[model samples]
Target chain A: MSASTIIFYILSAIIVGGGLLAVTARKIFRAAVFLLFSLIGIAGLYFYMNYEFLGAVQIVVYVGGIIVLIIFSILLTAESGSDMKKPALSRILFSALATIFACALTLWLIKQHTFHVNESTIIEPSVRNIGRQMLSTTEHGYILPFEVVSILLLAAMIGCIVIAIKIKPKT
Target chain B: MVITGVCLLAFLVVLCFFLGYMERKVAAFMEIRLGPNRVGPKGSMQIVADTVKLLFKEGLTPDGADKFLFNLAPFIVVITSMLVVAPIAYARDFQLWDINIGVLYVSSISSMAVIGILMAGWSSSNKYSLIGAMRSGAQIVSYELSIGLSLISIVILSGSLQLSEIIESQANGWWIFKGHIPVIISFVIFIIASTAEINRAPFDLTEAEQELTGGFHTEYAGMKFAMFLLSEYINLFVVSAIAATIFLGGWMPFHIGGLDAFNHIMDYIPSSIWFFGKTFLIIFIIMWFRWTFPRLRIDQLLNLEWKYLLPISMVNILLVTAMAIMGWHF
Candidate 1:
């Protein structure tokens, strides 16, 4: 096999192995750590695909920001030594069914699509192009979505504060 | 590429030795005491002895600790720090991988160190480690805003995220002089934020010895602990080099307007020397801060980032954007 194919297989193994371990791990903290490994594996896949900016974003936002947040909350609420309680049989069966359904859906979709491998049509993804598209006002621009997301985040922040702050009762 | 990787690894080891020794000497000089004078010629071989000792020492994983993760943390920390070294241009023609988004790449990758620390803390099953890791999580998340925004301001001025282009823009004059107020503000904010980012003193709440009892890596022993220490210095070196590259002109020598003769004389010095000289100067300033200031309280630390550095950096970004729009910068 070619080096790229071998590398792709290795990366896929890492992602799958880490994901399996994340779901099956007995300890919550270990599960979280496994989740981190899986996320990093996905970032590695992004790097392998030559999405440098996307790979960096994957690591920074998901591995650095989101995973850290998850671990922080785990540490705050759960004891490190305590393993998660086993799921009920019904719950396990439902989850297994859901997983199989998702896998079948993905496979069906993959079979339905005919992906053309057009080498000439593939444009190199540059940071400048990414930046222009992000801020552009054209039909394909992301400015509106970006602004909406920022506003949504602002609302979330305000809502969190409102919920967190305990108003003193009338004395 | 393999040769460059091996060479950089070698350089990292050698640099860490000197950094460890220099940090001690600086601390000693500040505190009015001699530090490690007997190891070898003013303690030059002290780090060597320490390394040897650590190598032979027992690496223990606590009974309650998760074996895989407990062993994995230090490697993650080291790898993240080393990955950032790729895009940095050591000299004019000396760069490992000059990626398109060099500045953004460094900023993003460097932030991943927190995960290793968090893993180290959580897997250890130690309360002190957990607390330290939690503090680090909050601290990094807060201060990263300032670090990122300050860098954005520089990126705005240079109009390129690539390191080489940014350095080229500073060829005529360093950004600290040419970009004027916004650059100065961003530089100051960057230094402060990055110093905190690396978790040095005055903001080292994570590893606050007296309080947290060695903090996140408290359970780490032998080479594992040593790796953590080494990555800390490597990170300091990387951040300082970036500061020099962005604000002080990477490998470029100082050139005044209408001073062709003087500029030519300055060019006689090798580019690597210019790069390292500026990097070390910034590193010295960071080390100076370590020795001069006491650690801040956890609340105070967060306040410094969110209340002070973040707002200042945001304003600086706006100011820089305006300058960039109006063509006010050199």
Candidate 2:
């Protein structure tokens, strides 16, 4: 197998395992930690894809910002302070069945579809090229989306500030 | 070196462990004391012994804690730092992947560390850890903006987001001496924000031992505690490396325009030595901040970010952009 394929397989395993653990773990905090691993695995995949900027952004925004907020909210809440329950056999069976069904559907689709196999060489995934494309006016240009992300972030910031404000203690 | 490609991760882990040893040794000297002298020559094996002790220590889960998140918190804190080992070119040809979005990728991935801390704090079912996580949640996000803004100046000036290219832009002359005032301001903001971003001293309310009783990881134990400690040091190295690369010119020989002898001496050493020497020096400064300064209150920290860093960095970016367009900076 090619080195890229090996890296892809390894990263996929990690991401899937982490995701599974995040949802399935009995302790709510361990699940959060598992989510972190899953996020890191996604970042690793982005690195392999040669989208280094995207990968860093993935780390900064999702891992650094959003997850931190989630943790803060979790910590602030008193109700979910304890682990609720362990997974039941029926629940596990149903989830397992769903996963298998999804896997089979993906496999069937893969067998039927024929994608354009580019018999081309690999290209350097550099930021300069991305910057150029981002600025271009054509359909592939992502300049609009890039600017829009800032606005979305601003909204989130406002929302967080509002939610985080504590009610004044009554006199 | 035939086994180099396959064992890259292993080497990184060992090297990081070695760095842990170095950090303590240096810290000891800085504080004017003998450190870890009982172990192998010069106390070298102490970290190993310590590692073993931690590994075997009893791991406990608080009775009221959310068990899953508590277990995952340290892992989240650690794994995020571990995975970001990519993109950095330690030497001429030693990079995990030279991804195009190098700068932004590092920023985003590193941010995940906060998530783990948050999980740990919230799930611990302890009031102290919860507040610690809450403080950290705000602390990291606020400082991130200025850090990104500071980095943007370099990205704009060098006109490339790739770490290598940023380093290459400095080959002619370091960005510090590129005679860009705006860049300098951004660099200043970057340092302050980064210090805060990592929740280091003056900004380390997350782990204020006295106030929060060890902050977000109050409930962590054994190997999990060790992971939190290791991840912090690694992150210190990572942030310092980025600073060295962006502001100080990573792996580039220092040249004072035409100081041939100094430039030649710089060239004699391998690039990795230069890169690491610069990185460690900055790490020392950050550690110094940790040891010397007092932690800021949560409100003060927030005010500092919004009222000061964010506005200043935004203005700095605009100034640098104008300078770039006018060809004012060399």
Q: Which candidate is the best by TM-score?
A: 1
TM-score values for chain B across all models? 0.98, 0.93
Give lDDT: candidate 1, residue A130: 82
> Judged by DockQ cut-offs, is candidate 1 incorrect, acceptable, medium or high?
medium
iRMSD, per candidate, in listed order: 1.0, 2.6
Give the residue spans of candidate 2 off by over 4 A.
Answer: A1-61, A82-126, A138-146, A149-170, B1-45
TM-score of each: 0.96, 0.80
Residue B324 error for model 2, in Å? 2.3
RMSD values for the candidates in order, in angstroms, are 2.0, 4.6
